[model samples]
Target chain A: MPRFNAIFFKLALNSLKSRQGSVILTLLAIIVSVYVLIGVEQIRMQTKQNFNSTIAGTDLIVGARTGDINLLLYAVFHMGAATQNISWKTYQELTTLSSVEWAVPISLGDSHQGYRVTATTPDYFTHYHYAELQPLQFAAGQPFEDVYDVVLGSEVAHKLGYQLGDKLTLSHGLGATSFSVHKDKPFRISGLLQATGTPVDKSLYISLSAMEAIHIGWNNGANSNAAHSVIDTQSLTPKSVTAVMLGLKQKTAIFRFQRVVNEYRDEALLAILPGVTLAKLWQITSVMEQSLRLIAVLILISSLLGLVAMLLASIRERQHEIAVMRVMGASPWFIFSLIEIEVVIVTFVGYVFGLLGVAMSFELAKNIGLEHFSIHLSSNIFSIDQLIYLALILIAAMIAGLIPAVMAYKQALGVRLD
Target chain B: MKTSILIQNLKFSYSPQSPLILDIPSWHVEQGERLFLQGPSGCGKSSLLNLISGILPLTQGYLGVLGAQLDTLSGRQRDHFRAQRIGYVFQRFNLIPYLSALDNIRLACIFTDQQQDSKQVEDKACSLLISLGIEQSHWHKASHQLSVGQQQRVAIARAMIHQPQLLIVDEPTSSLDHQSRDAFMQLLLRQVESTPLTLLFVSHDHTLSSYFSRSQSMNEINDA
Candidate 1:
């Protein structure tokens, strides 16, 4: 039986080799569609993973009154400037709440090169956790100690080619091309953080007192050197900070803490649950995801149809071949199975090549996604969903090839063989 | 003499609504008989051959081949019977174009009930090719690369590879010249001398009738 099957396989292989041009064209169509189908799925999954792992181990993020998503974008992601800053007095009072175990005040709205510069106390390093409550580890030195000390995230340090003890100044605004540069007080790079595969990898960390001291000799986003003080790290205290991340001693007290923060008497602050806000963000972008899904499915269907059409066209040309095989005692089922074997070979090869193509592109684009977009695309591309898609593609190919196989079977059974 | 084929009250048409194309009342051929049947074009010769080879069902009649009642067998059984017992050769396009001559010959043994290893099958093919006067250099070349006479010889080799009991040749000499046709007929007759093979040769030209032991026109046999 094995030898018999081997002969049939040889026949199918030779038949495909005989019609090389059409076979290659069909293979190209299948490869491209597989690439697109698997590519879209990988990106969708990686993007969701990147979003989910941004911030963890924190109960609530308290920021000035704004939309929950907006607060999340500015406080956790540092994507945009806050509408209003929380007063230092209000933050101090919030940290004193009985349920609050730890608090980290972060002051945003500064830039170093193209990366965001976040100013916070040393407590930020201790309390911050991400990606399954993994603590941030230093690749070089310790966290910021003096007012002029600074730390760099992995991507920021790598892209800027900075090392320990290197001094770089910040800009007053968050644009890539900032007009107001703070070149007066250059901060030393005290430490570098290992890659956490999160937005934190694209940020520069500095002391909050350094943030206040940089603005001392400036007014109204302009540098007035005439009234500039020499240097004062002692009286440098931030009057307002962008947001505060809080961790409660008890997980059950989160809702009550969020209510207390939201209904605060002194300030109009809004507190948000990060996971709920992330779900809302997905809902807002679900339409784009659905459209991409539809496009991928359409391409898959058309390519499969192209494969079927190619087989159907070959059936007409193979009529003589079919007649010859029939005269040699080949049954109608043999003819049918020959075409099916060809389809299986093509689809399986096309699927493998498609996966290789995706992996190669991921290798080329890994650094760019990490450095620029702060998205860490992992190298492991296989998932349960992708395996399911492979099975679906194979079944679809077999079902599609059935049309031509049946045609060839009927032609073989036709009464014309001399 | 042992009967190789028997036909009685055989009736055939393409479909129930189509006109009858063949209506043979009775016909029989003995074992080891070299019979030459002649008929002009469009005289139902091909249809009669189809019926005899089990390619067509016997709508009404008793048709037997090699002692097997072909009319009682199912379609798949008929196919198996043809594969195991009968060898067919066409007039033109006799070989699969893509396969090499050796592969083409070996393909004939795939459907039969015989179990032969690859080495044995390949040796059989090589011996048959050598006997048919096909050069060793041409054995591995694609069937299309061979000349027309060479292809026909290869077709004969393929038809006789499995050592069938009945060999059906359909106008295979029409494309060959007189000398090659004489040589081919001589070779075909010599190849079957070792076994008691019943050979049925059909053609439109009657000049080749001298090569057979008996001759009959299709009009004398088919009563359509």
Candidate 2:
């Protein structure tokens, strides 16, 4: 039976070989469609995963009364400028609450090169987690202990070629090409954080005291005046901070802690669950994702239609071939299955090549995306959803091929009679 | 003598609304006999052969081929019967254009589930190709690449490879010149010499009738 099946398979292979021009064109259409379909799906899934994995273990992000997504963007992603900063006293008061197990205050607004400088305490290294509660392991040196010491994210250290003990001064503003550089007090690179494949890889970490010491004489977001006190590291204390990340001892107390922070008597603060806010952000951006998916499916459907058309067009030319097979004792079902087998073979090969193309393009996109956009695309290429999509494509191609298969079957039967 | 084909009150047409194109009242051919059926174009000679081979459905008649009543068999059964017991050769483009000459011969036995060794089938195919004068080098080339005479010879090999009980040759010599036609007929006749193969050769040309033992014109049998 296997040998008998081999004959038909060989015939189909030879038939396709004879008609390489149209076959390759059909294959190219299928390949492009599959590539687009899988590529868009990969980006959508990877983007959502990358966003969801940026921060974890921290229960609530408390910022000075802003939209949830805006707070997340500024506090965790460092994407936009913070409109208001919560007083440092509010953060201290929140830490003293019974439900708040630990709190790490983050003061933003200083930049070295293009990387943001996050001002936080050493407690941040112990409390903060990302991507399934993975702790922040330092690749070199310890967390910032001195007011003049600075720790660099893996990206910043690697991109700027900064090693331990390298001194770089921070800019006053957040822009990449800031002119208001603090020339007097330069901080040494005390530590380098290992890559976490998150936004944590793109920031420089410094103590809150360093943040206040650097802005000692700055009046209105400008360079210091001539009479500014020279390097007062001992008496420095931060008055305000951009946001704070809190981790509770009990998971059930998250909502209560969030409510307590939101209705604080001293300041107008907003506490947001990182996961819920991320989901909300995705919901807002899901329309574009859905549209991309629709376009990919449409392309795949049209390409499958093209395959059907190609087979339909070839059936007429193969009338004599079908007649010969019929005379050689092939049933109408044989003719029907021949066309189907051809379609399956074409689609399967196209799918294989499309997968290869996806892998190659992802490899190329991974580097560029990480360098320019700081978007870490995961390397795990094939997933269950992708396999399901492939199965759907095969089934769709089979269904589309039926149009021509039925026509050929009818034609073969007609040839035998007439 | 065992009858290879028997037809009585046989009728065929393209559709129920159309007039009958073949109305053969009675006809029979004995096993191991070579019968030449000569006719001009559109005389329903091919249609008569189609009915006898179970290629066309029998609407009204008693039709039998190789001792089996074809009219009583289902379409699928007839297909299986043809695959195991019949060999058919078309006039032109008899071979699949892309398959090799050897592969074309092997195609004849593809549908049958006979427990034959593949090595044996391949050896028989090779010997048949060699006997039909198809060169060993040309055996693997695409059938379309062969010359017309060579292709006709390969078609004869393909038809005879499965050793069917009934061999139907429909104007197989129409495309060949006189010499190649004679050569094709000589190889075809030699293949059926020792076997109980009932040869039904159909053609519009009359010159080739001398090669068969019996001859009949379309007007003598089919009354349309």
Candidate 3:
């Protein structure tokens, strides 16, 4: 039986070699679809992981009444303008509560060359966490010391070509082409944070006093003339904060504390469970994954149909060669098995080529995903699911091969060798 | 003495509704006898060969080859019997065009139940190619790249590689001119004489019968 298989393998190879052009073209289709399927799956998983790890360690986020995802998008991600700011008196009162261990007030609504500028106390760095409570680490220098000292996120420093002691003025608003620059109170880069593969990588951190000093003369979102305003950082205080991230002293008191802030008598403040809100944001990103998978599945179906078409057409051209073999002592089963094995070989080879291509392309995507989106895209060559896909591709290929195999078998049995 | 073929009241038709294509009252060929049968095209010559080779079913006949009744054997058994004891050289010399001459000959050994080491199969192929006047230069070339004469020799070598007992040559020299035809006939006669080969050479050309040990017309025996 093994010897018969050996002979059949050679015969199949001879047949494929005779039609190398069509065989290679069919293989290319399989390779491309495989690559696309694996690529989309990897990117989907990476994006999910990135979105999930964006906020951690904070039990509740206190913002003005807004949507859960909206609060998360603006407060944690610095994506949009907050509709209302939390009163400083309310933040101070919230910190005094026995259930609150720490409250880090964050102020946004400023930009420096497209990077959001976040004004917060040094406590923000000590308590803030991401990716399983992973603490923020500095790549160079310490956190801000003087009011004019600023700390740059890893991406911000790397992208803007800034080093410690380089001074940069903040823009009045969040636009990249802002004309209202706060040139009077320029802040020097005091530190640089390590790349965390999260939203923190694209932010500029500074003390709340600096934000107040920069906007001292600004009115109605415009930088006022400096002729009468030389206010010192010590004399000004942040009038309001965009949101406050709270960590509970007792994890069990989180619900009670959130209720106290949500129904506070002084203002219309909203407190949300960060975990639940981040999950809501993740739903939007998952839609991207579904669309990509749908496209990949469509491509896979087309390629498989193409594979079946090529094999069926080849069977018509191979009737003469098969008749010759049947007379040369090859049985009908031999001819049938040859066609099946030929398709299997093509699928296996195309799968390997596609896998290699995916690995190479993802190697580049990993870096791009990190630098641009702060998403840690893994470049794992062959995950278990990918192996399952490989098995499925081969099985589908064998099933597709059966149609042509039956045709060839019938021809072999019916051919007249005269 | 064992008979190579025995037939009595054999009848064959493509389907039940069609007229019989082959009808023979009685026929026999002793073992080791060389029989050359000639007939015009479409005269049931190919049908008779198909029945003798067990390619067609025999439901109403006492057809036997080498003491085994072909009518009693199943389809698969007949296929194995043909592959084991019969080698056929077709009219068109249908060698796999892409395979080398040696590989084409080795394909015969692949279908047999007998196992041969690679060295043994290679040795046999080399000897057959050499004896059949296939030179070293042409043996390594692809079957299609060889001249018509070389391809014919390769096909014969392939058919004889398993050393089948009954060798059937169907219009082996129909494509050749007189000079090359004489050369091929000389080579085929010389090769078969050395083995205990029962040759059944079929062709319409009667001039070649002078070289065969036995000669008869297929239509004379087949009454349809």
Candidate 4:
């Protein structure tokens, strides 16, 4: 067997050298498929990591009765629409829970040109944490204390090109198409938060009372029989809020506190553990993730089939070569092993190239995606998922190569000296 | 002396639609015997050699080579028997184009578990090439770089490198010119005489048969 292996190695090496062009082309196909697989995996892992870390230090998110995914979407990502609003009385009652250390109420359902407008108290700036459990730090000015003061997230300021003391108007709805803006009640940008590469980087922060004050005039306008009216900021009275972010006194009592908040009789409100909600969101998205993984596996399988076809197609042209080897005392197994070794070599080369391709893509994404999307592509190469992908590629290649190896063995067995 | 190859009533057909091409009643080559078998193209000369070397299975009769019954052995066992005992040299296009002459010779050694010194093999290959009138400079060149005559000599060296008990030559001198063909034949006969290996040289040209101890035609054997 060792003697046969020596012959197999020499033959496989010589055959690959002779057919360098076809071998390289087949390898290139494998490399492209492997690159796509690893690239998608990296993006998926990093995006999930970014989403999980978007609001790490916050313990619970209080909102109206909804699914955990919906709660996470509105509270953490500021995506989609909130189904219901929590009354002022319910918010005040939740703060009195035994496990509630500090609670910051937030109001949503407003926008400033694609950026979400969040209304909360001064505690938002003091308590909100992002990646690495780091508190929000000011880039220029202080938090929004006055009713007309607005604190902008780093991306909001950079994208809108707003600076300190720059006056801005708010829109009534959460979309970019909001027609009614608070033209008469413009707010000055009081501060800019440093970039955190989280959803917070795209928010416009103001006081909850400010959000209520803006809607106060509209509430009275509905009774006065006007279609819609923009109220002066000074003439409005603050009322309701959208949701609240709760920080627990003890991490162990999060579930107990959530149960108490959910049973609130004053309003139909819900309190959710942010981590649990985020995990539920991940579960919902895992279907799409699994589909993406399946597609990647299919691509890898097709590439390996391409390898087998490439080898099998070349076998006819190499029959004389096989016959020569057989006459020289090489067994059929030797020929089969020769073909198998060629595929193994090609797969190994392709795997290396695939890794390099993924690394290069991440480097490109870090420079561009992080600046714009606030998503940092991690540079770690030894991720367990990636190792699994590599192992999968190897196993798939071995299985794929078996077809041609068997064909070679059969051909060698049938060879005749005549 | 032990018979290196013995065949009784061997029958073979190329395809199911075709009639039998080889129908030999009986044939035998003794050990150390150099027999020349002459037959025209398409007369199943190569088929006969394939059957004798255990490459092609006998359909109708028994074949025994080196004391092993070819018909009783499995395909794998036949391959093993051929590898361990029989050596074959083709008419032309014998050497692999990518491998050097020495590597071509060393390929045969790769099948056996016996330990062989690379230096001794190299020296033997060099001497074989020298004896076959192949220059030392031409030994390292790829098979395609050498002339037809030089390639035939390399093929001979490859076939005889392992000193197999039986050697089968398939019209090896057909591509050589008259002078080179005579010289190739002389070198081949001298090598066979030096070793106890049986030689079966197949060709259509009967003029070369006078040099061998015995010569026979396919018509005399097969009555085709």
Per-candidate count of clashing residue pairs (backbone under 3 Å):
0, 0, 0, 0
- Candidate 3 structure lDDT: 0.85
Tens digit of lDDT per residue, candidate 1, span B1-87?
989999999999989999989899999999999899999988898888887788877899999899999899888888888888899
Worst 10 residues of 2 chain A by lDDT: A1-10
Which candidate model has the greater TM-score, 1 or 4? 1
Can you rank all candidates by DockQ, best first? 1, 2, 3, 4
Model 4 residue B29 CA deviation in Å: 2.7
Question: Candidate 3 lDDT, tens digit per residue, B1-224?
Answer: 77888999999888989998889999988888888888989888888777778777776888988778989988778778887888888887478877788878777778777878878999989999999998899887768899887788888888888899988889989988889899998888888997887888999999888987789987778899
- Candidate 2 off by > 4 Å: A1-4, A137-141, A155-163, A176-183, A219-234, A263-266, A416-418
Candidate 2 residue A165 C-alpha distance from true site, Å: 3.3
Q: Rank the candidates by lDDT, best first.
A: 1, 2, 3, 4
Q: Please, what are the lDDT tens digits per residue for candidate 3 over residues A1-418? A: 3254565577678778888899999999999998898778777777777778887899999999888789988998888889999888988988898888899999998899989999999998898898889989989999898989999999999899999889999897888988888877789899999998988899999999988887776788776675745566567688799999999988888888888888999999899998888888788767777888999988977887788889889887777677667676677887888888888888888889988888888788887878887888777757788889888888988887888889888888887767
Clashing pairs in 4: none
- Per-prediction DockQ comes to 0.54, 0.53, 0.48, 0.48
Clashing pairs in 3: none
lDDT, candidate 2, A189-280, per-residue tens: 89999987788889999999999988887888876565765666667878889999998989998898788888888889999999999888
Q: Report how far off residue A239 is in candidate 3 (Å).
A: 5.4
Q: What is the lDDT of residue A154 in candidate 1?
A: 94
Report fnat for all candidates as fractions from 0 to 1.
0.57, 0.52, 0.44, 0.59
TM-score of candidate 4 relative to the true fold: 0.85
User: Each prediction's Cα lDDT score?
Assistant: 0.88, 0.87, 0.85, 0.82
Per-candidate TM vs. native?
A: 0.90, 0.93, 0.88, 0.85
Candidates arranged by TM-score, highest first? 2, 1, 3, 4
